[model samples]
Target: MKRMFTLLALVWAGSSMGADWQVTQSDSISAYVLCHQGDCPVRTAKVFDLPVAVPMPARVSDSAAKPVTMHSSTSVRFALASARLSQTEKAKLKAFLKRHRDARRFLVVGSTDQIGKKRFNETLAYKRGMAVAVFMRANGIPNRNIKVDSRCCIEHPPSTNPDARRAVISINE
Candidate 1:
């Protein structure tokens, strides 16, 4: 019977020889050893080295006031001497307004081609800006947030060759 018990112990040791062991550690400084077989006795366990802690990066404050401006990719075009918005222009402006719903302020600046008289063009520009501002107000943007400006033909046109008659919407935050 003693011989049979010794043989059983030898078999168990042989089976454990091919098994694998793993150790896992976390920030809590506690570790666990996993053995493929039944709980193996832990002997002379030591941590050779520990990982160093890294400092976290600082985050930017949300309260910092920064001005952000965005312009429409395509100008809102109008027929000569008219402030009426075309169907396409209306759709484009609607899409723009929807995208910038979070904007706190907007500057609608209008311009005209150099073909018309300076004073007439200036009046036309102002009217066009007012039209856009009115549209924005109708779409739930507050009047206080809307600022109208008319450039007439003073500033360089966005497009050099084409007629400069268009409304430009600038969103500010």
Candidate 2:
């Protein structure tokens, strides 16, 4: 019995590269003998010292963990050659903005009809786009989130008779 216990302790310590051992063998009054050198009768340590390895979990990036954003657009038409917002147009734009309160960006694009001088039409389109930008600012949208693109005498959505005067507002969340 004594030889068996000693042999087992030697094998366990050798396999583990000098690891501590604790003998749980039976005796007349059973007890344990814990030591560093694996010697039951001559103990040099009372505490067990052993190395254990645990694997870490994989990591995820911000783009991978986050949901993809999709863009949505709304078109608000202006009266011929006018940069002013009518009451009904304002109401419709307000409702659209309310539905997109969490939007990350607001791209306001103003387009003009082809019946005017190139420079005059460009300025008018800019004013129309700025009008939409100002309305967005008043409705709690920040200045940094708003961008204006003024297009004059040019067809944004190509058409055969492209004289449409409108502001297209696109939001991306």
Candidate 3:
């Protein structure tokens, strides 16, 4: 009879406090405990983003690639003393224009090393900047929407930075 009374007391204690509250607790605690040795697979969740406002193309083409979302600033590099765009740089510029088709304006600022004659460096910078501008025109941007800035050349001390012979492209959306 004494043992039965003790068992009854225990049951009453549990009934008054915490039998159901624990069942509703998160399973993440147990999952976390299972990862003590870092072998457990982590759970993942999918994310959804808001939609974009891309306009319809003026011409329908079956061969045109889909447009991807990309950055607002990019730099296309050139060889030393050269104003020409390499095939890789051409691809980069093409992809950039594709991604930012709705941009209002584009700025191409050309830069060159300070080791050349001031007039020659400025001329090379202008040619580099204009090359990018011309590419933009070919890709459908109007001449009014593109501005080439060549004043960025030979103004600063020369450095080994690879971007010294590059055209920086910035977009105004």
Candidate 4:
């Protein structure tokens, strides 16, 4: 009898807590933002925090956002002076693009390290961006569905976090 009453009391407490209204909850999108070489100090790492929530925004989709696809250089290095992906990095790009082959369109946006000349880095970034698109096309993805663009390196440098070297690919059906 005592044990039963204790269990009932616990259940009642749980129910009472559930009756409380929830006002605001923290939410976030998890992504790796690479720090380009020159923009952030060489060989230094910066950390940041992002939060996320369940039942994501109605306007945005990709329910499986938890496991983000990531590919990084051996060190916090750049391919040219600014771009991140190298020849070894190329294989991961192929796989990353292949994962979203069924999508109607894939956007490949490239970024750069803050070290090089702007015009050169911009062109290089575009090439890196196209490099991914080309990989997708070569692997049987339709050309129409792949879009590439490069926005130079950091317009505003992020902390020296190596994750800041990242180029991101988003797939949309």
Candidate 5:
């Protein structure tokens, strides 16, 4: 008989609290008061001291906005004070051009060591660049797509290394 009275008291206490209140769990917590019957005052009641979660907008990728650019270079050595291409160097240039035939643009840059006069080195570099450009054009590269440039001892200076004076064929896409 005593247990029955305790059970009845617990049931009464639960019934006094509104059944319309619901708790939902997500990334954050939310409480909602829903009224199945019309015009329940609990539906409009303000909830205090509970955090509400605001949903964030979805993110978008921007990979398409930037284009992919690829670059490659091959060094072709030339004789001192001359812009002539050796047979081995010509073969190397041919192979390099064939490998990068599909590139969008080609930049043939020539550089010389700081041994000769500055003006002469500049002319030498330009000739070397032109020679590589001509070869590329003959092979298959479009005339408009190829750009010839000469650094002319500005970057690489005279050293024991013969490779300091050379034509650099660069392909870019």
Candidate 6:
């Protein structure tokens, strides 16, 4: 029994000395014995020390992992030429914004009909954009999160037809 116990002990020690391990990305940061060298035990190593550790390193297969996607806020489209917001539209939009205020960043774009001249359209668009942004700001939205852009006559051509100047509000999460 004593001989048997001694034999088992020797076998255990030998097997532990030859423990099979791979210097994976995790192991590269630590030290462990590798199976490649029959009798060599690797000591503590920095990631730079191992030459084989980085050769054609394992590629992260996008397909193998679950696709990571970020959620985006739905875009709100409103008619700019209209003078006023209908009651239902205002209520619904206000409620939605109230719920999403924490994560929303807004962009208000104002456009004008190509009625007078290019310069006139540009001025109108700028004012409309500013108006929309100010309106939103008045409605509990912060000024910091809002961006205003104008597309005057560039977007609207009076030659095409008579159209009202417009403003649009967009939100991003």
lDDT: which candidate is best?
2
Cα error, candidate 2, residue 16 (Å): 91
Off by over 4 Å in 2: 1-64, 155-163
lDDT of 2: 0.81
lDDT scores in order: 0.77, 0.81, 0.77, 0.60, 0.77, 0.61
TM-score of each: 0.55, 0.58, 0.55, 0.47, 0.58, 0.43
For model 6, where is the 10-residue window of minimal lDDT? Answer: 69-78
The number of residue pairs in model 5 that clash at the backbone is 0
**Colliding pairs, model 1:** none
Report the C-alpha lDDT of model 4 over 61-83, residue by residue, as the tens digit: 67876765434222212444545
lDDT of 5 by residue, 63-170 (tens): 777666777888898888888888999899999977877897888888788777889988998999898888888888899999998876654544565556788887
Off by over 4 Å in 1: 1-74, 154-163
Put down candidate 1 lDDT per residue, 1-173, tens digits, no spaces: 99679756755765678644445668866453436555665557677787788988997778766755654433588887889998888899999888888888898888787766889988998999899889889899999999998877644553673437888888765
Which parts of model 6 are misplaced by more than 4 Å?
A: 1-96, 155-164
Candidate 2, 91-118: lDDT as tens digits: 9999998888899898999988786788
Separately for all candidates shown, the number of backbone clashes (residues 3 or more apart, or on different chains) is: 0, 0, 0, 11, 0, 1
How much lDDT does candidate 4 score?
0.60
Residue by residue across 30-118, what tens digits does model 6's lDDT show? Answer: 53334635554555765666456556867786767864443433222234443344555456557766766665577767677655677
